[model samples]
Target: MAASLAAPAPAKGAWLETWLAAAPAASGELALVQQRGREALRQQPIPSSRNEDWRFTDLALLQTLPLTAASPAPAALPEVASGALRLNWNGSSDPLVDQALPAGLQQLSADEIAQGLGHTLAAAGCEQHWPVELNHAAAEHVLALRVTSRSQVSLELVSAAGAGLQALRLLLLLEEKAELDLSQLIEAQGSGLHSLVIEAHLARGARLSHGLVALGQADAALLAHVAMEQEPESEAQLSSVMSGWGLARLEPRAVQVDGAAHTTLRGLQVVDGQRIADTHSFVEFKGPEGQLDQLHKAVAAGQGRSVFNGAVRVPRAAQRTNAAQLSRNLLLSDRARIDTKPELEIVADDVKCAHGATVSSLQTDELFYLQSRGIDADQAAALLQRAFCEEVLRELPAAARSWCSLERLLEAAV
Candidate 1:
């Protein structure tokens, strides 16, 4: 059973107080949700080395940040072609749409959203994580999207930063037979903290593909959490690329309410200097005939560090399930570090599940093979690195795969 968010003492700590003072006021259902979030934070202490889930990542810098609300800033929408929904957030809401939305897609207002907030929160199992509660407490807006058609649509979420904390919340629902292609770009420009929570629900026969890119300043910190619920015959694919943050953590969780659902997760992280990038994922199958394919790759240069932990759970009822998880990493410097753990837990009698993790440096033989072909050492290394990352990058949607910014991101890594 999840922990109860009953009446509790007000949250303490300078960071909590700063966030509360800067946050905007809410009323009615929204206010109640915020209060519950506050109580949850008060009841549970901050995570530290004592917690197994967070042992590998340090939180000293996060604890000392002046975590206030992000101040409003003017942001121009990115240059996206028509037929895309662009949402720019610089402590305010600016939605740019070049084309009209398809028939079954609509955005919900705060009051309209409150009607279904309870079920949405419950379905996401929000009580299990603290960062989610913090997001609920500080998020200034609740951007809710509902899709009910078989049409293809694009969504972009852009987050601009201020001097303090930036919190954002998103809820997405897809009815039966619906399809959506979503992309999110987060850019933090200053020395502060950013938190985001995304809750998604996919009904039977629904399909969703999500892509995310996170770029942060040298002194910035980021924490992003995603929760998804899938019904029978539903499918979801999540692809993420992250870099440039001083400290960052990305957690994605999915649960299959019924069986026969398909879930795919792919992630790539490139970090250098003193940056730290961490990703943790969890997928649970509750019924039979479920399938999951997961791959996570990381490249660490200079004195950077990369961490990954992925787990898939199949209960007794989840018979005939097929799941595979792999984590591959590369280290370019002696001082760089990579920690990866891929896990599978199965209680079913008949199921196929496999998990493996590998950590190595650029192979001398492979590098030599490329260099011998008339390519300079630097160019050869870059070529090899790009090849290493392409395995996961190719899994993105074609539109996202063709983005020039993504090409620049890979070049910058080299």
Candidate 2:
């Protein structure tokens, strides 16, 4: 049986209908999947404040936007170094992948994607989620990456759209003993709405290191969803950094299908002006000896708002599970707001679980100490802020840890 979550309330107005009508036609098994997604959208309501999961997020702005399919003209491709596969999706341009692939990696074509739609659709269960269903119904193409052996590969996923609405879907598969390092960068230009959905599967002993960074224009809104399933002895590490979007939501979910699995999640969100950044994550352990460590940090300046909700579940069969979650937030302005919740539900008596949350401002004594040591006030504050974010950034893959754009964003935030 497929697992389900409460769908976002049905969206108001004809945005859905209009977007659906404008979508390109799909054939074969892919068509069937889109049909199912369309039907599901017709049945599910857009999420509203009434829904507990979306209570802190106001969808008024999203509801008022005139949504349409993105149609940006193709621009010159950016220069990227060798040794990694780069995919650029600008809603209208043809998807691009590196010319050469590593020994154990393969990229799936449209026909191959169509043939595998059924399995992918089943694993995603898009019928139960609104954003995911919309992605399924409107995505221009399906991008898939398959790893079949003990290999190390880097992927750069770039999403840029013009005005209106854009959606993209990515599927990643790691066979037994396989490993992958993925870096996703979302750059939303102009005024519009963008949605991204990623589905990944890891077989026994497989490992995945995933990182994401989102940068958006002043009027852009984004919704990103990531779901992963892991077999016994599988491991996953997810790290994310967000900023610049007017309104954005990042949701990542993981399930341990067998025993002795390990999962780690870390995130840092920085917002200024009137922007809002929200993150919601869920992790479930289905068997014994599972472990999870999660930490999320937010820094809000100006009148920006940051929201975080993390939940971890340890079922009855998940004995000897170890889980810890923490949410740390810093407010740089009196007007800025931070809302955080760390939760755990453990049904096994042998499990050890702990959760905590903190909302604070720059420590006065620390600032004073820095000032006394010859640093100016502004420099002191920036240093402290950088240190606070390092806890999460340090966990990113080495190459991604030094992302220039990310570093600049952090400096600007301070």
Candidate 3:
């Protein structure tokens, strides 16, 4: 039996107990938002080095530091602009940061809050290690968002430093036949971990176009979990470009629960400078007549490491489900490395699911050809690298363009 608490210990022993304990609890549907997370943490502790899922990553990096409680700082008008999305952080106090978002997207009901639960190892599978363990434990740094209408909301989410172990809960609900085009930016200061749990609820005939790009301090780690449920005739065209320093992980997970919902996922991962980056994506078809398409790209150079995992599962009830996943990797140097895994689990009798992976080095012939021309070997390699990434870059929407100035990003990365 679970031990009872006068209230409840702070979440996951995240080391943010005092900070979260000082925040106010939710009064709406997500009434016990903070309490439930704490309870869940109390029941199942986050995995450490013993867990396989996190074996490649370090969990103790979070427990070692004595981080001062995270507080929201005032943000001025963003210097950059893309797709009409302008971001301004007017938050002074951490408590008031919860209310700082545009009032157009606040829906903190109990059911909605409950839906945000279960991202933990205890919620998914006991054996796996969750990346957002500490963030979930803090629970106080959550932001719930609801997108209605054809929302052309351009967003730039900045993860400023000094705010260690924070969770940004984004709840987006697209109304019937509504549309949402969003762009996300994650930049952190100091060496701290930041996680964002994005819960998207798409109504019948709704559509969502989303993109995310992140960068952090060398010792920091970050994760983003996107959960989406698309109704009949709804569509989600999603793409991402992740370029960062340090140990970073990106996971895009979604389930189609009804009708003809479609999802398109395209991703790019670049690692160098002894940095390690991983991108994991999963799309599940739980309803009838839905389709999903996924493509991933990874490039590892120097002594850097990279990993890509793309999975698609179709349940028996999901008749006429069509799914496809592909992963491609490029190793620029002999020391550079990449681990690519593509998986498909389909129980549906009538469905189409396929997966493929490829790893190779830069073509010497191409290099020779470029050198044969006016281009030198180094320039040729950079050009080829640029071309190799062009496909993924072109797949991104306006949201991605703002987050990752790809051309500028690659100049330094390559």
Write the residue-wise lDDT of candidate 3 on 181-288 in tens digits. 676666655566666666677788888888776655556666667667777888887777766556777778777776479888888878777777777777877788
Q: Which of the two candidates, 1 or 3, achieves a greater TM-score against the reference?
A: 1
Q: What is the lDDT of candidate 1?
A: 0.78
lDDT of 1 at 130: 71
Error of 1 at 322 (Å): 0.7
lDDT of 1 at 35: 76
Tens digits of per-residue lDDT, candidate 2, 104-204, equal: 78876666666544353344343267777777666666667788878777777667667788877777888898988887777666688888888788889
Candidate 1 lDDT over residue span 1-414, tens digit each: 245766664444656655566666755445777777777777777776689889888766675666766675544444765776666755334342454655677876666577655454466465447777887676656667888767567766667776788877777888898998887777666778888888888999999998887777668888898888999999999998887888889998888888799999999998888888999999999999999999999999998889999978899999999999999998999999998988888899899899999998888998898888888998888888888889877887654555425455644333
lDDT for 53 (candidate 3)? 46
Give the whole-model CA lDDT for all candidates, comma-separated: 0.78, 0.78, 0.65
TM-score of 2: 0.89
Location of the lowest summed lDDT over 10 successive residues in candidate 1: 90-99
Off by over 4 Å in 1: 1-13, 21-29, 71-78, 90-100, 109-112, 118-126, 402-407, 410-414
Ranking by TM-score: 1, 2, 3
Candidate 2 lDDT score relative to the true structure: 0.78
